[model samples]
Target: MANVIRRAEERDAASLQHLQAATPGMPEWTQVHWLGLLSGDAIVVIAETDGEVAGYAVASLLRIPGEVVAELEAIVVTPSHRRNGLGNGLLRYLLAEAQAAGAIRLMLEVRTGNGAARALYQGLGFQEEGLRRRYYRDPVEDAVLMSLQFPQEAVAVEKGQE
Candidate 1:
């Protein structure tokens, strides 16, 4: 399947809601939240396959003491589209967007039971940083924190040219 990853627009709210509804294990975000995100500082991207929203990823840029960080808020893919690289595509797009926005690090938390997600993150060079106990409610699961740090050399080179 050919998948196109693009920035989400306000008009995509309904399709995003529908896609989220069809996906389990995703955060229950309201329409208000979706709209707010589209207008907020958060970076959101959706994967489209054959004219349908297949998956999406959200991240927020944060200014820390000495660096900008991108915190991955959510990532969800419809069940029927799993294992087809939609998830990976969404994540890679997010990473590129974050880096372009001056993020020096990308962080995320995933349910410990979600082996597939963990594998995906690891495959992309995200290292396990820590764990949050009882981070999820519905099933009372732990959350594994993972992070991918951009190479310092790359950041330095970019800064040097500025």
Candidate 2:
């Protein structure tokens, strides 16, 4: 099946939320929250498989005094789409988008038990920076903080310079 990945619009929140609901250890977000994200220019990406949402990646930028960074809030892929590169696509898309927005760093926290997600982030250059105890409340899980620096290449990309 063909897959198309792009910046998520307000209309996609519904489908994206549904896909997210299928995943465990994730907080359910409301449409109002999702809409606010798109309207504010926060990073939100989605993958469409045969025109249906298969996954999503949400991130936000933080500017504290003189420092600015991007944080990945969540990255989830439906069971039917796991192990098919959709998650990686969504992640890389988020990294590229955030980098273009002047982000010097990309960070995320994944449950230590989520080996697949950890492997994916590591494969994308995100190294474990720390650990948070009881980071997830749903089933009570620990989280490993991971991060990757945006190389000079991030500034040299010829596409989507805006």
Candidate 3:
């Protein structure tokens, strides 16, 4: 069956936690965190395949003076769903929403050892911006900060031609 990406709802809290657990490098967030994302400047979306939650992504929208920026908080795909484009679908949905919300940039940090995730992000036009020392626990590792900047839409009217 094809994967369907949709907005996350309150009912998805438990399933989101389950996905997090099934993902090895995912951050451990509590129910409170999931609840907080449901109704704020945050954007959350989940991918479902065969009536099961396959992956999810969370991001926050920040209006910075003249531009809006999005910070990706978490994105995890179930073990069985990895490498099947579920993560890519979830991120594409989130990026479209962010762009509609006026966000011109997206930022995220991934564990340095997570080659799969890093490759996915890189393939999607995200560039490595920086590195954080010893960012992960359990298995200590550094984090590679990545960001993608969207080009501002050009105005319909030309400067001199108008």
Candidate 4:
């Protein structure tokens, strides 16, 4: 099936909500919350296969003391769509978007037990940095923090690096 990845629109809120409901451990966001995300500063993208919303990913730019960092807020693919590279496509698109938006790094936290997700992040160059104790509550799982750093050539040049 042909897959299309694009920026999410307000019209996608319902589909997103449905996807969220179908996925366990995903944040239970109301349609209004999803709509707010589409209209807010968050970067949200969806993958459509055969005109159906197969998956989506969300990230937000965070202003740190001296630089901006992108955080992967959530990513979910319908159960039937898993293992088809839709998640990878959504994340790759988010990575490019975050870098283009001047973020120096992208960060995320995943449940320690989520091997599939951990593998996906590692395959994409996100390194494990640390862990948070009891970060998820449904079954009280720890969260493994991961990050992907973007090359800061511009910043280095500005700091007088050749």
Candidates 3 and 4, the one with greater TM-score: 4
TM-score of the candidate numbered 3? 0.88
lDDT of 4 by residue, 1-162 (tens): 989999999999999999998887676899999999899889999999999999999998998898888999999998889998999999999998887777888999999999999999999999999999999998999999999998898545444665
Stretch of 10 with least lDDT, candidate 2: 153-162
* Superposition-based RMSD of candidate 1 using all C-alpha atoms, in angstroms: 1.7
TM-score of each candidate structure, all chains considered together: 0.91, 0.90, 0.88, 0.92
Across residues 1-162, which tens digit of lDDT does each residue of candidate 1 receive?
678999999999888878777677676787778899999888999999998898899999898887889999989998888998999999999998888777898999999999999999999999999999999988899999999998876666666744
Q: List the residue pairs that clash in candidate 1.
A: none
- Estimate, for each residue in 36-103, the C-alpha lDDT of model 2 and write its tens digit: 99899699999999998889898899876754589999888888889999999999999989887877
* C-alpha local distance difference test of each model: 0.89, 0.85, 0.86, 0.92
What lDDT is obtained when candidate 2 is compared to the true structure?
Answer: 0.85
Residue runs of model 3 more than 4 Å from their true location after superposition: 154-162
List of clashing residue pairs for candidate 2 = none
Question: Candidate 1: where is the Cα deviation over 4 Å?
Answer: 156-162
- In candidate 4, which residue ranges exceed 4 Å CA deviation? 154-162
